[model samples]
Target: MTTTPRRYHITTFGCQMNKADSERMAGILDNMGLISSDDPNEANIILYNTCTIRDNAEQKVYSYLGRQAKRKHQQPDLTLIVAGCVAQQEGEALLRRVPELDLVMGPQHANRLQDLLEQVFNGNQVVATEPIHIVEDITKPRRDSKVTAWVNIIYGCNEHCTYCVVPGVRGREQSRYPEAIRAEMEELGRQSYPEITLLGQNIDAYGRDLPGVTAEGRNKHTFTDLLYYVHDVPGVERIRFATSH
Candidate 1:
């Protein structure tokens, strides 16, 4: 008897960070023996790792969700999930908007996909954007073929830039313990990831909110401090970071 690999289609929208998240998730799915489908209608599982960075991205995700929601009515077995910023920012409000969605999870919860899906197949819909300590990036990411990779030095953003919903949605700046960040970088080095981009909402303001942090050389113990902290992670050739406010 031959069984086809369970197929999944992931529709990604938003920035490099979200794209990175989706790739990591796709890696997780690959570990589970699921193949990705280019066609949305043909996949047994439909996962939308949504983005809410702009109004257009949010609306687009909703429109796609609507179509999938309607499809779920006809194909009762079609598993539906909405992940990333919108799922976190909106939470159960998403269920109010589209009750047909099987799961709603946020960026911080990205590493928990397999466990959440396990709960979904168990017949319970889930929303898991609650703030928690991002455990560790133990799952192998199905990275894009570029020699560059994004390594999140911190989880969540404390800077509640008024126009931004990151703090409310993704939670506060939880910098990975400097030690852990170095370890992750060391591993990436072993994998030959040549260029690494440290992720954050505001890199200039890293450890201001966290305790046990102080100045690093001429600067405060902010993202820059951490940069010096993990700069020597073995095998890493280069490093960079991004944030406007």
Candidate 2:
């Protein structure tokens, strides 16, 4: 008998940032030699890289998680992961709501999927919501498009908007080092990626949390500096970004 190359299906909801996170996570899985799947029920691994920007979006994740939870009960080998904001906000409580889930990790944990899944394979369910120092970008994501890509220049948020819970859930901002970002851009160029949209909950706030040099010998860092650093990377045709107030 032959086994499959562990298939994964990701159901994403919410905003452009979530969509981009899904792609990057997908890219990470593909590099781990997993194949993509369209049906969550058929996949050995089902990842719901969800969002909780609205009440409906959060409730919907539970409903959808319900169906998969049932499937996992019937298919003991099935691996189910709940990722992104909902996982961040609810944390381990998500497991109480759906005890069948094998992993619950937040959005900031996207790049660490492989290690977390390994823990799951060892018969330990995992929840990685506690704040962590952002790792260097090394994993090659199985990018979704040749025409466009989402490059996260920063991880997490610090805004602490009164109406939002992101800063608490995502933790403090940790910008990717300038050299590593350039290296990734260069790799994307080699892969023929034509465009890259710089992603962040606050794109305009990219480097505010990091140390930097200034024209007047003052401590200064801005998203614009990061932009100019990557602006001329080869083979990239276009660049766009967003900032949420």
Candidate 3:
């Protein structure tokens, strides 16, 4: 007997970081041979790459989860995942609120999508919210734009601004090695993506956590230095970045 092919739908909510995370996760799914599906109801796996920056966005994730949780009763084979900031913030409470969820993973775990789903396939409900030294991204993102792409130079934020929930949910600042950043851009350049956006929760805070210092006591890997490092990538005509402190 033949088994039905698996399909996935990823609904992303909030920020360039979350969108970037969604693209990476989608790439992982594609690598695992899952086809993309437009309709959440028709997909065998439904993933919500969420944001908890605002109260409304957090509430919105629960609303969507409720509908999918109900559907899981009848579709026992369906896999439901809550990933990104809200999942990081809520943790196991999300599982308590929606027991049908197969995986509750944080933004930091986006690169581990395949491993997490393997546990789910084995009939296990998994929660992976603990902080970690983020793995260097090797997955090829399914970029939403043919002309533009997002390259994450950094992950998380160090600031604990009273008004923002970013630091609490995204954990501390972790910068990707400059070599990896340029390599991703180089690949994007070869793919004919002319414009690339370097993404981060706090774009201005790019290389503080990384170890390195210039002879002049300046950070060797500051965002300014990074800009210069990847400036000459072949085929990429323009570069942009996100929110600043």
Pick the TM-score winner: 3
Root-mean-square deviation of each candidate, in angstroms? 2.6, 1.8, 0.9
What overall lDDT goes with each candidate model? 0.82, 0.82, 0.92
Q: 1-245, model 3: which lDDT tens digit per residue? A: 98778999999999999999999999999999999999998898999999887778888989999999999899999999999989998999999999999999999899999999999999899999999889999888998989999999888888889999898889899999899999999999999999999998898998988898999998878999999999999999999999788
Among all candidates shown, the one with the greatest lDDT? 3
Candidate 2 lDDT tens digits, 88-180: 999999889899999999887887988999999999989999888878756766666778887788766777878988787667878777777
- Candidate 2, residue 134: the lDDT equals 74
Candidate 1 lDDT tens digits, 1-245:
99988889999988777877888899889988999889999998998987787889889998998898889999998999999999988899999989998999998888899999899989999999888777777787887766888877666676677887778777777766667678877888999888888877666666665566335434245676787788887777889887647
lDDT of 3: 0.92
* TM-scores of all predicted structures: 0.88, 0.92, 0.98
Question: Lowest-scoring 10 consecutive residues by lDDT in candidate 3?
Answer: 51-60
TM-score comparison, 1 vs 3, better candidate: 3
